[model samples]
Target chain A: MNLLLLSPDDLRADGSAVVEDRRLQHMLQVQRVEPGQQLRAGLLGGLMGQATVQQLDSHQAHLTLLLDQPPPAKLPLTLVLALPRPKMLKRTLQTIAAMGVQRLVLVNSFRVEKSFWQTPWLQEDSIREQLLLGLEQACDTVLPEVILEKRFKPFVEDRLPALAAANLKLVAHPGEHPECPRALGEQPLTLAIGPEGGWIPYEVELLRKADFAPVQLGPRILRVETAVPALIARLY
Target chain B: MNLLLLSPDDLRADGSAVVEDRRLQHMLQVQRVEPGQQLRAGLLGGLMGQATVQQLDSHQAHLTLLLDQPPPAKLPLTLVLALPRPKMLKRTLQTIAAMGVQRLVLVNSFRVEKSFWQTPWLQEDSIREQLLLGLEQACDTVLPEVILEKRFKPFVEDRLPALAAANLKLVAHPGEHPECPRALGEQPLTLAIGPEGGWIPYEVELLRKADFAPVQLGPRILRVETAVPALIARLY
Candidate 1:
């Protein structure tokens, strides 16, 4: 874990904190942290800081908090992606969070298999687990908000206007000339990546009419998870 | 697996083929192929074709090859990347291969610690393993060539000229202006990605002087593995 994340409720009234969860075990076993050792730490939804280990036992550990800096900056880009396969979904969330994306909108597309929606990974806790892994990699604590949109049209027509109101919008599709701009100026961006087989023509057109320019990532098609990180990197 | 890849030596004198390795296991277990099933197949350094499942046993499978359509088109790009951590290195090879990258030039960089070079994953077999994974994903048969350049300067100055001769060269670094263009016309591409902390200014300048156009993928910095897919998607 890059940053040891704790919840605010986990802090004791006396200002000391006890960590008895799996994270504590990871600290003790994987990191091999000992008493008095300093660790980079954070409180979920709280400040990022240094923590000094004060006590350790088989089951729990205590530490003193000292928030030193502000939380890591959130990526200015918002990603709206078609749901990927469950295995890819886990890695995608971790990567998105690690890159500090503030929001992710998982939308349904024609190419998305119906069976994919049934995946247990779509569960709330499962989603959070992946996000936490990303945060750990980046040593950040804030979790990005995730929204699920089962229907494309209603969400696009009803909510996307507001979402795109303050952002530069782009959709990733193949065969569009000149493609999307690599460096979006200072404006916030809302970028869309399609499913494995990619968006149908009508879907691409809808997004385009909604102000999302259809852009190509060259000739080679990439898998959804790989494409997400690639798009995020270029647009952020 | 994308396409079943067989080495030239795997071909028997009678022109029938036997596959008894992990590829065979993947075909039997994951693909669940039975006799008479037709699947895409390719030779490692030869042709791609349709294969009729002739027979299957617990340990091996037999196939009758019918060379038809050629192998899928490869990415018209060459990747020059600083060697990543061993884990990332494995994924990078797999991802690049899956994307149909033709060649990989793994180089040294400032942020790339010296110890990363010592990883057993740098061994040929391990690297080939990852490439096969990528090929399986794309259903392509050709394996990309992985070249290592321990010293950056000589390789950049000597070898790059010949490689960049017919391609547009791009080096991914943060802070380049007007940002990078998303796609160049259908010429071959030579793209470079930096180490985790990025290429030092000197390295960036040297690359530029060596005819690589320095490009930025927006403001948020990305990990090397993330950058690879992102740049590939943008360029290819």
Candidate 2:
């Protein structure tokens, strides 16, 4: 982990924090941190700075906090993605969070297997852990919020309109369409990417009704894990 | 698998092809092919077309090839990447191949763990298998050639010059480098990406001597798997 992320509960009243659990394991095994060493650390949803290691053991490490630097700015984006398979979904969570995407809406698509919706990885804690890993990897502090919409048509018709209001709405589909825009001056955008076999025409039409302009990333198809970052990087 | 890639050995004198092994498993289990069905197919490193399933059994599938369309064009790029951990390397191979990067060089970096150089994933058959999966995913026929340079200084100093000759050479380093270029009109280019913690100053200097201008992908540090496609997409 690039950043040592601490929850509020980890903080003591004396401006010190005690880190345990997986972070502690990483410190002991991966980092081999020393008592006097300072780690680039951040509080969850808060500031980022350094934490000087005060004491260490198998159980926990005591760290003094000095968070002052603001976290990096999140993208002005709300990604509306088809729920990928469980394996890809895990990586996509981390990928999106690392890229500074702050809002995500996972929706159903025709090609998305019904079995995908039943994965335990969609659990709240499981999702947060993956996002935390992304935040830690990128040295960011704030967590990206995730929303689930198991029903496609209702979410597109009832909910997506307001969520996409006053933003550039786009759906990243393959085939003949305009090239995915580059560095569009950091405008707030809601981009929907489809599943493996792509969104059927009816689904694309539904997204179109929500004012999402269809876009393409050329003729070559990419896996969702690869495409997410590619699309984000090209945008801004 | 999107494309059933046939090696020359699989071809019969009568223009029929026999596929068995893992591709057969995928065809039977996932695709559920019938006796007279057509699927997109391609020959390894050659043209792409369709395969009509002539017969199917648990052991093999006999297909008739009708190759007319050429595979999609490869990018005018050569990517030099630091050897990632084995798990990431597997995905990176598939990703680069899928994105039409026909040439890749995996080299050493100071930050790269020594054990990464020893991974079985770097073996010829293993690498080819991953690249084939990528080609199948993207509906392409060409396989990317992968070269290994275990020594850092020698490859960058001795070999990289010729490899990067007359191409737009770039190194995707983090920090105060110029922003990465976009859509340079398909000129031949060479890009080097570092391992997890990024390249040290010495390595960057050696690359600089070889005419590799340093470039940045903004502030967020992405995993290597994410960054590869990101860089490729933006460059093209």
| TM-score for each candidate, following the candidate numbering | 0.69, 0.98
Q: Which runs in model 1 stand beyond 4 Å of their true positions?
A: B1-90, B99-126, B132-142, B147-236
* Tens-digit per-residue lDDT, B67-181, candidate 1: 6666667877889999899988988898898888889999998878899999999999999988887876666777888899998888888988887786888888777455666
TM-score of chain B of 1: 0.92
User: Model 2, range A57-128, lDDT digits (tens) per residue?
Assistant: 999899998999999999999999999999999999999999999799999999999999999999999999
C-alpha RMSD between model 1 and the true structure: 6.1
Candidate 1, residue A42: Cα displacement in angstroms equals 2.0
| DockQ of candidate 1 (2 decimals) | 0.29
Worst 10 residues of 1 chain A by lDDT: A176-185
Error of 2 at B193 (Å): 0.7
C-alpha RMSD for every candidate: 6.1, 1.1
lDDT of 1 by residue, A179-203 (tens): 6676564678898888877889888
